[model samples]
Target: MAWYATPGGLSSLSAPQLAAARRSYDLWSSGNPGLASKYSFDSYVEYAQQRHAESVAETAEQEED
Candidate 1:
């Protein structure tokens, strides 16, 4: 099934929109945006947290080997 967002939110995106979204995510994630952009502050934080957790879990698994 196709992905979706909120009713009045970004439920869908075009090619350019997807590219811009990716660029926006990459930019805000590098500690440069400083949580200033209201568009993706929370999402970016959640993405970073998920990445951190995955990295931590991977490291733990590696150390156990």
Candidate 2:
């Protein structure tokens, strides 16, 4: 699956947010101008939240060991 967002919209994101998005979605790393743009800020937030939760869970599991 691919994720897409407008260049204008992507441009509005903070550097950290853009970095995170690129990290999350490998396809975005290619520097493609605009192809099948589908994501919005909300979607990015959700993705970030999920990653946070997973990280928290991993930490908790590690602590239990």
Candidate 3:
């Protein structure tokens, strides 16, 4: 029911979901030694937003059937 913007597009991630993404990204980056060299935090956030959008769309499509 809520929306936010990322470089990828508009996203439906709520504040809590976005917070979760941040935490997840932080954890993932800390755990992966090569992470910091490859991607910036902003890029990771964008990726999470895009992934969340795809997940929402896929779930909606499945439910419509």
Which one wins by lDDT: 1 or 2? 2
**Backbone N/Cα/C clashes per model:** 0, 2, 0
Best by TM-score: 3
TM-score of 1: 0.42
TM-score of each: 0.42, 0.43, 0.61
lDDT (C-alpha, whole model) for all candidates:
0.52, 0.54, 0.66
Candidate 2 achieves a global lDDT of 0.54
Q: Residue 33 CA error for candidate 2 (Å)?
A: 6.0
Candidates sorted by lDDT, descending order?
A: 3, 2, 1
Q: What would the per-residue lDDT of candidate 2 be over residues 1-65, giving only the tens digit for each residue? A: 11233223355556776666667555542454253156544555456556666777899999999
Tens digits of lDDT, candidate 1, 1-65: 11112111233445565555567677765756565455474465345445666777899999999
Clashes of 2: 2
Q: lDDT tens string, model 3, 1-65?
A: 22223434225456776676667667988898597569876677777667777887899999999
| Candidate 1: residue pairs that collide | none
